[model samples]
Target: MGLSKRRAHLRKAWFKKGCVSPKKGQTVAFPTVADNEFVRFEKKSFDRRVHTSNNVLTFKDTDGTDTTVSALRPRPNASNVVDEYSGCGDESLYPDLCTNKLMVQAKVQALFYSSFKEHRQDKPNCEGDLNFDAAYSIKWGLGWRELLKCTKCSCMCDYHNLYEEVENKKRSG
Candidate 1:
């Protein structure tokens, strides 16, 4: 189903199951920032009612990629709202808003994890096998493979670069 419809259905089911009555000008539903499915969030506030994006500041780069400024990251203990996974944040406009922001981040994480689990390919287990050379780059495309290894782990991977292929194709044709 469409994300909007799914959100609506989930909202209805949630309300039917008994939530604190919403007040005027509160966000009823908002889309998760993923290319996947919807996620249900616990309704907390009954003080306001308005449909608005939780994000106040969002910017896209020339490549259409979302870019986050480094100065925006909150220092430790900057806010009362503490995310169990991501830790605390900078001072929020309000505590409720801070909590909601953490919840939204968690929701985004959950959605991404779900999508990854659904479509991700199983990687080779490199537990005892920390040795990774360019000898095992999977050849699926007519491109040069760049060897990459995880700094935190022994896992390694190849990234295909089509620049060399395009040049060769141009020369031949």
Candidate 2:
């Protein structure tokens, strides 16, 4: 299949930023995020030059308003995006999700779903942090160890490799 739905959405969003051909060793700001964020595209190496991966994306924070940028919710085709102040439901008391930490969490959650896929699958009826439950974790065969590993590499290779392995096993079986 072509890129998965989420992956395609990310690519479309990235491309909409007018990233036609990012020069080598050049830094470009992702238009989806605020102007301070910088993403450095990788240089094409020797043999596998066709496949270049951008591994360095940096966020530059300035002290003032606009400390955080809101992600585009209700993904273009998504029908279930809720109107919540904060996904963690702490906004009523905390009231400050614009902090750097929460910004990072939101970005990570948006870009990497492999780590949260099990939770999302288990709690399809719920939104935000409520999707993560002990019962769902147990039913999905995920625990602290698996969670740790997923968090470590879900944005990169671990999840893809595991998916491929499972696909291969299914095909062979």
Candidate 3:
């Protein structure tokens, strides 16, 4: 039978057998539900909803490669709002955003001083790795990778460049 028809039959059978509302002091046998199938269905539905949303931002470079930048990552704090730094004169902006401005300046120093490789093979991913590199650079001295500004988009996508470089190499090979 079709899935919908089977589900309807199961629903009717469940209702008929009092699975929906058990009698007083009586045990009810419920119809079996596949957890994996249910989870897969839910994930598919959620993915559809996310992809259809207006909040999703996509960027296409001059090379015609589509890059999607969707979803704002929340701060480590419990609150939905990102953490702000009062020191930046404009208290409204997140500290991390303010830090990027400093990073832009520091990149000039790195260009002359740092011996970090021009192309990094191990491109960083995950919040921990990204944050860890950013965090440690202040105390541990300047690293090789400088936050390179994209001439096309004018966005400070340091990691994005690394990933793109790796992808280009793979395609050429």
Candidate 4:
């Protein structure tokens, strides 16, 4: 019928056959009542006990599936113990709780630089009739003017005047 009923029936049968003995604290043991049997009686003896405390037991059945049993009672004072363990007033332990701060920071920095370049590229044309031509002028080296000239007009102009003219054209346009 049910698991408890089946276990009780097995216990009664074992006890009646002198195959088990009852002990204190919900224990049952197989004890040797007589000798001269071929089975090596002492080696085959074993004990079975029922747990009365809050513990989890995992068992596997013959079909290879697992069964888990847990206590039904709730632990007393668990929240109070947890609160005491984590201090009543502490903020330093929480440190913002980001999972990957360095990776996020690097991604944000990369986004900022990418957006800055995009904004510079998207600015409207400003230089109106300046024949700003230079192959590799030292004055216009590695500046926004050089970049804009290389990108837009295909000619490099004076760095200072190119920056001012670009800004002025951006504002006007």
Candidate 5:
């Protein structure tokens, strides 16, 4: 877990730059082409090390007109990866995910049931029927979300953002 977290921090730092290596109380080391030491137009050149003080990657080059450098959307495979996105973590940890409009609401709803139980479960929900309800909270702007509806008490559990919407939909629909 710490490995993943460290990797996440490193990735974020890598993109923003200004990172000094941990050894030098900085970040990382990137090899750079010494443009100032060029012998001729296409003759000789020198190599140097540049601090990752800017967003551009010193070691990378693009063949096109794009001078700026950025991380590709699809990341490479990693032995350890961290979920660093603000709203893109486990539901149990970050329940207030609705604020980030970019986060996707639809996913494997199985993990959320325990979260539902953790926050909204009452003492009398032993006979609750836990299942995924596709259209339960759509009109509330939550998009497709799961519901933990207790058949015994008719009490429902959902995302914090969907509480009012789910209730209103139940009443009107």
Candidate 6:
């Protein structure tokens, strides 16, 4: 069977099993509350309580306007892309500790390809001829490690080895 047909079959099965369903056409009705009551609940839920030590300050901009900053809301536990450096930048620094070695290697290979493309584009051609030195530099050792380290956080891990392990797993799997 083709991929699309298989997907459609799976979707139908999912709906039949109550795992998936279309949204109801009917509109949902919500209960209306008084402004005062809403304000009270909003204060309790979002701002907590106002105390001398824990009280949050509200201020207006330069143009004499009152403004209030909402308290930080709790986030749901969901998978998200985090960069290297544990926050942003090179993936080598903040390795995806959650992911298996195979996944990490795949990511590194993708990175290598992207970097190689950029390196090729940056070099000037020798009068319509390709720059052999620049090509060699990119193919042999583009200093990807040093570049990654400088841009990413300081983590004492061999990313090349990690990539190799992941690649091996990918091949086997």
Task: State which candidate has the highest TM-score.
Answer: 5
What is each predicted model's overall lDDT from 0 to 1? 0.38, 0.34, 0.37, 0.36, 0.43, 0.37
Model 1 C-alpha lDDT per residue in residues 39-118, reported as the tens digit of each score: 22223211121122685544333455654422223223333333453433555222332221112344334434543343
Candidate 6's displacement at residue 93, Å, is 13
State which candidate, 5 or 6, has the greater lDDT: 5
State, as a TM-score between 0 and 1, how close model 5 is to the true structure: 0.23
Which residue pairs overlap in candidate 4's backbone?
Answer: none
Point out the worst 10-residue segment of candidate 4 by lDDT: 40-49
TM-score of structure candidate 2? 0.16
> What TM-scores do the predictions have?
0.15, 0.16, 0.17, 0.17, 0.23, 0.16
lDDT per residue for candidate 5 within 54-148, as digits (tens), equals 66434223332422233233233333333344354466433443344322343433336464555353654365554434335443454434454
For candidate 6, the lDDT comes to: 0.37
Residue 157 lDDT (model 4): 28
Best by lDDT: 5
In candidate 6, what are the lDDT values of residues 76-121, reduced to their tens digit? 3444455332353454433333222232446566555554454445
Model 2 CA deviation exceeding 4 Å by range: 1-96, 102-112, 127-173
**Residue 52, candidate 1: C-alpha displacement in angstroms:** 78
Clashing pairs for predicted structure model 1, backbone only: 24-49, 25-48, 25-49, 25-50, 26-48, 26-49, 26-50
Candidate 3's TM-score: 0.17
Q: How well does candidate 3 score on lDDT at residue 11?
A: 78
Q: What is the C-alpha RMSD of each candidate to the true structure, in Å?
A: 28.2, 30.3, 20.8, 25.2, 26.2, 28.1
